[model samples]
Target chain A: MKKHIAVVSGDGIGPDIVREALKVLFAVGAKFGHTFTTSSYLAGGAALDAVGIPLPEETLDGCRNSDSVLLGAVGGPKWDTLASNLRPEKALLGLRGGLGLFCNLRPAILYKQLSDACPLKAEIIGEGLDLMVVRELTGGIYFGERGRTDDAAFDTMAYTVGEIERIVRKAFEIAQKRSKRLCSVDKANILNTSQLWREVVKRVQGDYPDVEVSHLYVDNAAMQLVRNPRQFDVIVTENMFGDILSDEASQITGSIGMLPSASLREDSYGMYEPIHGSAPDIAGKDLANPIATILSVAMMLRYSFGLQAEADCIESAVSKVLDNGYRTADIHTPGMKKIGTNDMGSLIAQSL
Target chain B: MKKHIAVVSGDGIGPDIVREALKVLFAVGAKFGHTFTTSSYLAGGAALDAVGIPLPEETLDGCRNSDSVLLGAVGGPKWDTLASNLRPEKALLGLRGGLGLFCNLRPAILYKQLSDACPLKAEIIGEGLDLMVVRELTGGIYFGERGRTDDAAFDTMAYTVGEIERIVRKAFEIAQKRSKRLCSVDKANILNTSQLWREVVKRVQGDYPDVEVSHLYVDNAAMQLVRNPRQFDVIVTENMFGDILSDEASQITGSIGMLPSASLREDSYGMYEPIHGSAPDIAGKDLANPIATILSVAMMLRYSFGLQAEADCIESAVSKVLDNGYRTADIHTPGMKKIGTNDMGSLIAQSL
Candidate 1:
């Protein structure tokens, strides 16, 4: 396979981590008879500092031309005082919106070797956790009409039939790929947005006849995620609710540095990234963890480029490295050796 | 002091549990130099069966006439098919709305003895979880404009400055009574409703000069709740977020059956109940936990009747019974005796 992957080493430790992710990708390619062409681009705070804009035209062009895109963490306190439209995080919203990345897949998986690092009990973290959250990427309250006045403020959570249908269809398809169990979460009892969401999801359910479908109130789903996450397979929800729940789900996996996510449009191209933010506090300190970014590359290969064998190779290498107790500062266990960012990335590449 | 308490033994195990709560109230009354006048009312499914409506005219009359109201669990599957206006859950909402109960207080407290039952690790669970979530009960998305259309649907998350001011003031007052720490949670980074919410909360902070105030985006706050719950003292948020977070917080106490909540108006009158709904599956089976309902009666005494000593007596009895390993079916641990609902309620009252 020959693939062109656009790389956005965003801000803070992004540059260093992306270097390691690229290194791993090259090493995997050399060993697996695959060829990857890498192209670097500007994004987030770094882009703003260089060109007075977060997502530069050249950067979007680079991603649009690639087979897949890999982004490191973006945004930080440095951009906190910037105007809302100019802030580094706005770049993320722009890229997702511009690319029509409607399906955001955030899988919260607990690696058996890292179970001890989880905040949850051993019993609750039993066996291993595997659940994918399919969040509608570009719609809902996140991009809905919002306004404020001197006395009152409003934000509309709006969903069109077409929007709901596509997201629910993607959810059922993901369920078909996994355990064939789908849970559509909403607040149907109260919100009409939710009522329509439920109705549309039910309509989509008929198409995926082999998949088992269930519905849960968003509140109850949040509670159940903590109470027993094992019960879920493929969970789908609206953008804002998914934003919160997906983050909560990330925490269950022990370290945000170990989680990766994919934002995709229907064109078989996607953006992959670690589900972490720019850690300015530890930036330039060589303390960042690169596993999440490396794992993101793995997802790019499998989901975007359709190089399944190469992706599995990278995933297994990550598992083996964890099995051998190689730990980064964030996921360090009592007896595990804590290595710096580059060293951890090098170890995973070596394992690959 | 003489206090008149209106007790609404709702449905399912409501009557059985209220029998014990009343006994505890009487026991506390006997210990303190207080006299109590009790009145009973019908509500929930029981009320529908007896009076043809969930909240009958007589029940509302009783609630209006009493100093405070103590309600047992309400709603179950039996009323699932009832007309929306006559559903048992509506009775609970009607009571809150009719009484102008705008501030809903749900305290998440983890008894030292019950910490082992929590899903999160002991270190994350921390010493004792004692944060009070003061949720705005009557505003925000919960009561916002909602509807469905042929091709789309929407719900407005709306908030008025006056509404936020009152709720924030109530939260600050509650924080002043607690550890003097308050966290105002919202999605100010994304939603206009939250931006106004943040601004209003900040403006209201001037009134509470002595209390420490902090702002957290709701997504970050949700993650923080699981990562480090002990960091919070008093959390205030809009309705929908509060409903979800409060339930999540309650689960950290091990069993949902152990959490009590109160919906109050500024006049000091409130409707008290456990956060758990009626368990129709075990409704008549005597398997429900009554400690939460019993503890709610304690809150009614303290916050409504101003009988602090009586409330203390009830609380100490609950603590003492739990200290002696009195486990209700819902919170049963290995080797702990699983007592029936009535037995557990009676045991706590007897301890009082």
Candidate 2:
């Protein structure tokens, strides 16, 4: 198999982490007998520095032309003073919008090796926590019409049947592949958008009768996430509710630095990245964790490339490394051997 | 001082819990040398049963005429099949709107005696969690324009300058009274209403210079609530965000059964109630937890009647009862002396 990968190593430790991820990806390709070609694209603060914009047209074109996109992290204090639209973070919004990435998959998994970092009690965590938050990225309040007048300001939270249907269907499909349980969360009792969301999800439920479906008010869902996170499998919700709930879910894991996320379009094309921001303070120090970025490569393989076995191998490598007490600075314990970012990536690749 | 109190003992364990709270209130009044006159009003499921509406005109008038109102839990499964407007839950909304209660104060306090009930690990719940969420209750998306078309549905999240001002002022004043630290939660980076909310809060900060203020996006705030709940003092946000966050905050305490909330208007007139619902299963079984309702009475005295000392006495007395290992069935643990609702309330009253 031959694949073209677009690499957007944005800023600070982004380049360092992406470099390690690329090494691991190349190692996987070599071991699995796959041909992978990569093209570099300037984006985020890097683009703003090289060019005048956060997301150059050439960079977006490069990503669109590629089979899949691999991003590290974006934004830092250096670009914080820029206008909102010109800020380094705008590159992320621009790419997602330009690529039509509607579904964002954020998996919050508390590995048993890192269970000591979990904020929840042992009883609440049960046998470790692993849940995916399927967030609708393109629609809902985030993209709604918003304006401010002299005395008042308003934002319209609107959703169409098509928007809700697609996201719910994607969530159902993901659930079908996982535990066959999906919980669609919305404030159906109050918001008209949520009511319609529920209606659309219920309508879509007929297509996948094998997957069990449940509905919860957003508020109750937030509470349930903290009270019993282990009960959830796949949580689907609108953009705003998803934003809040996913962040809440990630925090409970107590290992935010090790989480990976995937933003996918209608097709198999997706952009995979680590959930953590660029650590400018530790940039070039080899102190950053590369496991998240490596796992992101694994997600790209499974979701975008359809290489399930390859993805599983990479994931198992990660688990095995952690089981062997190989820790990065972010997840280091007293007895664990603390390895550099490059070393950690190499360790996982070697294990594979 | 002579005060008029409207008591709304709605449904299920509502009447029982209110009875216990009344006992504590009267005890406080007797000890503080304050004269209190009470009037009973029907609302929620009880009103729906007696009259055709969940919130009757007579009940609204009674609540309006009183200096303050004390309410137990409302709504039960019996009224679940009623029309949207006729539902027992609608009574709470109707009262808030009719009474012009704009600011809702939800205190998520994890009592030291009940630390074992907290879902978070010992380190995360340092010194016990105690924070207040000041939510703008009568406005924002819940009361804003909402409609469902054939293909799309929308809800308008709008906030006027005056609306934001009043709520921010209320929150700041509360923060001044408590920890003097206010964290304003909003999606300012995304939504117009939140942007306006942030502006109004910053402007209001000038009036309360002594109070420390910080801002967090709603998503980050949700994460921080789980990561380190002790970092927050007073979290002020719009209605929908508040609804989700306060519930999340309460769940971390692991004792939702013992939380109280207050809804206030411009003046000292406020309505207080337990955050829990009407548990119809235990309606007249003497198994209800009255601590939340009793705490609501404490809030009523502090906010409405301005009886600080009296409120302190009531709070301390309730704490003493818990310290003595007396618990209601809902919050009872092993080795704790579980008492009936009436007995628990009487014990706190006697201590007062």
Candidate 3:
């Protein structure tokens, strides 16, 4: 097997963590008889410093040519003074839009090793929490037409049937691969957009009869996540709801540093990244955790390259390290052995 | 002092719980030497069953004439088959709109007596959770202009400067009375409506210097609610965000039966109710919890009548009862004495 990934180690702790994740990727490639090649691309503050732009033309082109894009993170206080459009964070918006990635897959997995950190009680969480929030990223309120008048300001949440259909189909396909349970969350009782969203979901659901489908109003869905997270497997919703819910799902797991996300298109091409932000304060320090970025590589393998066994191997290796009482500074407890960024990456790679 | 209340004991357990709450209200009046008068009005399924209408003209007129309104609960399976506009739940929307109830106050209070019921770990909750969500009920997405085309469906989220000012003022006034901490939740970075909302929140803060003010993106706010709920006091947001957050806050408290809400307009006049729904299955039986309704009475006294002593007395009495291990079936534990709705209300009234 041969794979080429566009690597954008954006800024701050991005370079450091992405380095460790790539080491693990190389380890997976060697063990599984696969050739994984990566091309470095400038984005975020790094590109802002190098070429005076947040996202260079070369960067987007490189990602478009590659099988998948692996990103670390994008923003910091250093670029806070820059104009909104010229800021480091704009790289993310540009990439997602330019690449035509319509849906975002964010899996919230509560590791048993880090279960003590979870906000939820033991009984509520039961065994462990593992759920994916399939967010329709390209459209919804965030991308809607908005304007402000003298007395009033307005934002329009408009959704075409085509937009809803694609995301619903993607969610159903993803559910078919996982636990086969799909919960479509919307405020159909109120919003016209959600009504259309619900209609499209129901229309697309007929094709995937094997998948168990259900509907929850956004309010009830938020309550259910806090009350009983174990009841969910795959939660699909529009952009804004997904943004709120996915973040909530991550918080309940109690470890934001360990989560990875993939922004996918209709095809297999996707952009993989750690959901956490770039910590400029700990930029050059070895204090940053690399597990999220490493797990992102696993997502790229599983979702983008269709390398299930290889992905499983990488995931298990990371889990095994945690099970063996290894810890990064952020996720470290008193009893666990704390290791630096490089050491943790080496340990995971050697284990793989 | 004399107060007139419009009592709309709508349907199902509505009558049973309202009866108990009225008993406690009478007790409060008896102890304080105040004249309290309640006019029983028909609404919801009860109104529909009697006159084939969810909310009658007489009911609306009675409520408008009263100092305050106390509602039990509304809607059941009996009215589920009714036309959308004629359904029992339409009474709520009608009441909120008809009364010009622009702002909704939902208090999410975690009782130490039922701390075990809370879904969060003990460490996260700290002392206990007590926060109010001041939601702009009459504006934003719920009341926004919405329409559907053949290919696309659209809903407009529009906010006037006056609308944001009113809600922000209400929330600040609420915070002034409480711990004096206000958190305005919005996605100002993206939506134009939210940008105006944030500006109004900022402008309103100038009038209240004693209160500590802050802002949070809705996604981060959702995460923070699950992560550390103790950090907030009064969270004010637009209607849609409020609907989602207040429900999440209530679920985290783990006893939905104990929560109460208040909807208010420009004047001191308000409509109060339990946040829970009509438990039709327990209509004839003495199985409903009366505390939420009783609490709603306390809110009416505090907000509408400005009878702080009466409110405090009612709250303390309820707490004393719960502290003494009295519980309704909904909140009953193994060792706690589970009493019927009538007995629980009688006990709280006796304590006062």
Candidate 4:
């Protein structure tokens, strides 16, 4: 097997953590009899420094030509004063729009070893937490028509049947592969877009009858996430609601440093990254956590390269590393063996 | 002072709980040197059974004519199969629209005695949770124009300067009387309406110089609620965001049956009720908790009638009753004296 990957070590502590991720990826390739090639491209603040643009055309083209993209965190306080469109964060928008990545998969999994970090009580977080937030990335009010006047302002929340169908189909497929349960979140009682969302989800469910499906209003869904998170498997929602819920779900795990996300197009092409932000204050320090980025490579293997066994092997190595009492600075408990980012990544690679 | 109250004990446990609340109200009136009058109206499934409509013309008129309104819970499975417009819950919409109650106040207060009921870890719920959610009810996406075509659907989220100003002023006034810290949540970076909201809130801040103000995106706000709820004193947001956040806040408290809410208009007219739903299964049994409805009366005394001392008396009495080991079925613990709904209400009334 062979794969070519585009890598973006954007800014701040990004380069430090991303370096460790590639080491783990190389270890996976060596263990599994596969060829893995990578191309480094500048983006975000790194690109702004070199070319005065957050996202260069060459970088976008490199990502487009690759099978998948692996990204470190982007943006820092240094670029915070830049104009909105020219800021380092805009590079994310440019890449998503240019690559046509519309479906966002945020996995909020709380490993039992780190359950002590979760904000929820032990009773409510029974048997550990594993839920996927399937967020519609390209549609809804974020991309809707908006305008402001002297006295008023408005934003449109619009959805086409095609938009709803694609995401719903993706969610159902993922649910079928996992626990075979999907909960579609919407505000159908108030919004027209929500009604259309429900209709399309129902239409898509017919094609995947084995998956149990349910519906909840966005308000109720938010409450349920805090009350009994164990009930959910895959939760699909619109752009803004998803934006709110996925963050809430991530926070409750109390280990945002351990979570990774994948944004995909209709095809297998996708971009994987850690959900945590770049810590500029710790840039170039060996203290930043690298487990999230390493796990992101695992997601890339499963979702983009159709390498489930390799992905599972990477995940197992991560769990085994934790079991043997290895810890990065962010997730370190007093009893655990604390190690630097480089050592943490090297240990996982050795286990692989 | 004399006041006339319109009482709507709508469905299921509605009648049972409202009776206990009224008993508490009369006790307050007897001790506070005030005169009170009351009129009962049918407005929910009960109204549907009698007058063939969930909200009859007379009930709306009666509530409009009164100085203020006190309502019990509404809706049940019996009314669940009805058409959307004819459902028992529509009566709530009718009352709010008819009375012009545009500001919804949801208070998530977890009593220290009931801290065990909270879903968050004991360390996270330090000092107990008491935060107010001031939600804009009549504007934003819920009241905006919506339409659906065969292939697409859309809903407009619109806000006017006047609308935002009124809600901001009300929130500011409420904050002035409470902790004086206000957290305004919006998605200004994306939506035009949110941009206007921030602008209007900034303009309104000139009149509220004594109140410390801060802003957060809705997603971050949701995460903060679970991570550190005690940090918030008062939170104001758009209708949809409010709807989602208030519910989430209520659930984290884990004593939903003990929370109360209020809906107010510009003038001093308002409607007060419990945040919990009508538990049809526990309707006629003495198991329902009346603390929320009784607390609603306390809110009415303070907000609608400007009787702060009287409101404080009611609140203190309710707390004192719990201190004396009286517990309703919903909030009962092993060593506490468990009592029926009527007995719990009587104990609070006697304490007042």
Please report the candidate that would top TM-score against the real structure: 2
Assess each model's interface with DockQ, reporting 2 decimals per model.
0.79, 0.91, 0.89, 0.91
lDDT of 4 by residue, A56-129 (tens): 99999999999999999999989999999889989898999999999999999999999999999999999899
Better of 2 and 3 by DockQ: 2
Return the candidate ranking by lDDT, descending: 3, 4, 2, 1
TM-score of chain B of 3: 0.99
Chain B, candidate 4: TM-score: 0.98
Candidate 3 residues B215-299, lDDT tens each? Answer: 9999999999999999999999999999999999999999999999999999899999999999999986899999999999999
**Candidate 1 docking: what grade?**
medium
Off by over 4 Å in 2: none
Candidate 2 structure quality by residue, lDDT tens digits, A53-148? 999999999999999999988889999888778989889989999999999999999999999999999999989999999999999888988888
Highest lDDT against the true fold, candidate: 3
Q: Model 1 RMSD to the real structure?
A: 1.7
User: What are the lDDT figures for the candidates, one per model?
Assistant: 0.87, 0.93, 0.95, 0.94
Scored against the native two-chain complex, candidate 3 gets a DockQ of 0.89
Residue by residue across B293-317, what tens digits does model 1's lDDT show?
A: 8889888887787777777888888
Q: Cα deviation of A133 in candidate 1 (Å)? A: 0.8
**In every candidate, how many clashes are there?**
0, 0, 0, 0
For model 4, the chain A TM-score is 0.99
lDDT value for model 4: 0.94
Ranking of all candidate structures by their TM-score, best first: 2, 3, 4, 1
Residue A59 Cα positional deviation in candidate 2, in Å, after optimal superposition:
1.3
Which interface RMSD does candidate 4 score? 0.7
- Quote the lDDT for B62 in model 1: 88
